[model samples]
Target: MSHHRSPPSPPPPEPPESPSSVYCTPSPQSKATTPSPTARFFLSRHQSFIKPSPLTKHILPRQQSSNTLPPEFPYEHDTAKTSVGLYLRKHRRTNPAIWCSAIICLIFSILFIFIVVAILIIFLVVKPKTPVLDTSHATLNVIYFDSPGYFNGDFTFIANFSNPNKKLNVRFEHAVMQLYFEDGLIATQSIQPFSQRRKETGVVVIRFVSSLVSMSSNHARELQKQVMSNKVFYSVRGTFKVRASLGAIHFSYWLHGQCELQMSSPPSGSLMARTCKTKR
Candidate 1:
């Protein structure tokens, strides 16, 4: 037999170690003794950690807090307007331009208040009133027509302008008078400018001559009928520019006067009844 002996049988397997074999606590009796390196390593890893509960939640802030902002404050939305007053008005700063702006604003405010006061005072003191106008007399000098549509007439009137204001003198300028038979305008004339003292009346004499003035057939026929019946209807309209004088303050306005007259016909016609209205 060959002398090659089989390999020595393997050593028997050792028993498994306990689960706590890698870690051990030092007894109080060995407190003063230093541990080995391996023991120190195991001791260092002997910490205990708690597991998180499934139902628990963390407390975290919805937003981070800072000294520059208040918590839960109601704030106005910021805008991007480009006005210079957004930066300069009512802000705490040492700008010299702010003083100049403030002074100008104050001056303007004072001027506005002074102007308002002056107007109120003037209104109270003046107590201005409008003047009055009246038609005192009318005369139909003559009337003759060549044809039904052709008209010829001569008319005269006296206009009385009265100043009813207790403290105002009135002047009348750019005066014009118009004569109408029914709805047809027959003639127009301009009068001279005049003036009147307070509470005084002034008269203006106006004469109108119509030659070959064309009228509608209805107006012509109506005129003939009225002349035959010895009753003529005429309209007189007058316009004037009136100025009221109150010491250093004077104001002007337009004045209008209208008169309706019934008169006897032909050469001796005179006003029988009248209605007048004046307005501004």
Candidate 2:
């Protein structure tokens, strides 16, 4: 009798199992498929991701900030596009004193060289001329002795100077006399005079008896020995001051001359021939 009881309503068909109920069982595959919190955050920021294999979950549509740079960005290319390059370019174009100073120095050196050359040329082209004056007559006699007996036998010289240039003025400061024997210089004498005039005949007597003997003995022993054995030729030089008045103009004169020395012996009573020729 119970078997016919509505087939027992088929136990309510156990209400067909829901899809959630079937998937509710703890499975390693389902747990592995779930994304981690870190991975989800990374996908949100990048917007895109890719997975090459089943072990990896890749987000798609990666995103980037317009102002932010990536880890692999090129720094050298970025710097060239910024303001730093423009500043360096502008600084090199201005500033010129360095070049200007070099040019100015070169010009000054050339000018200095030209000035020196011009001075040398002027000196080479100009020369001074000597003036001529009137002449007079004069005589000079120089004697040489061996025994220092003539005029006290000491080495002595007599000068008879006459100025023929009557129209000029002359001033003499230092008068030097050089005596020469056959070998070399035998004696020298210096004299100072107050003054003299043009057309004036003056006598400058120089006595070199002891001084000449001593000097010749020290420097030229051969000359002294020759003088002792034979007569020696000597020369005399004189310098004087003269002033000449031609109209209202006054001029100065310098006189130089040479004379022969004739030797004579008193004790032996023999006169030697002239050994020295006058040099003008």
lDDT of 1 by residue, 70-142 (tens): 4344242123233435776656666889899999999999999987876576568867666666777788988
lDDT of each: 0.81, 0.49
For candidate 1, the TM-score is 0.61
Number of the top candidate by lDDT?
Answer: 1
Backbone clashes, each candidate = 0, 19
Stretch of 10 with least lDDT, candidate 2:
128-137
- Which regions of candidate 2 deviate over 4 angstroms? 1-153, 210-230, 238-254, 266-280
Per-candidate TM-scores read 0.61, 0.34
Q: Give the backbone clash total of model 2.
A: 19
**For residues 1-280, what per-residue lDDT tens digits would candidate 2 score against the true structure?**
4555455445454556787657456589877987789988997777656524634324332334234456477685477457667876775653588778888999999999987775454345422112222112212233343443221234555555454444443445546766565535546777765344555666666655323243333335544454566555555544443343444544455555555564543233223433222111
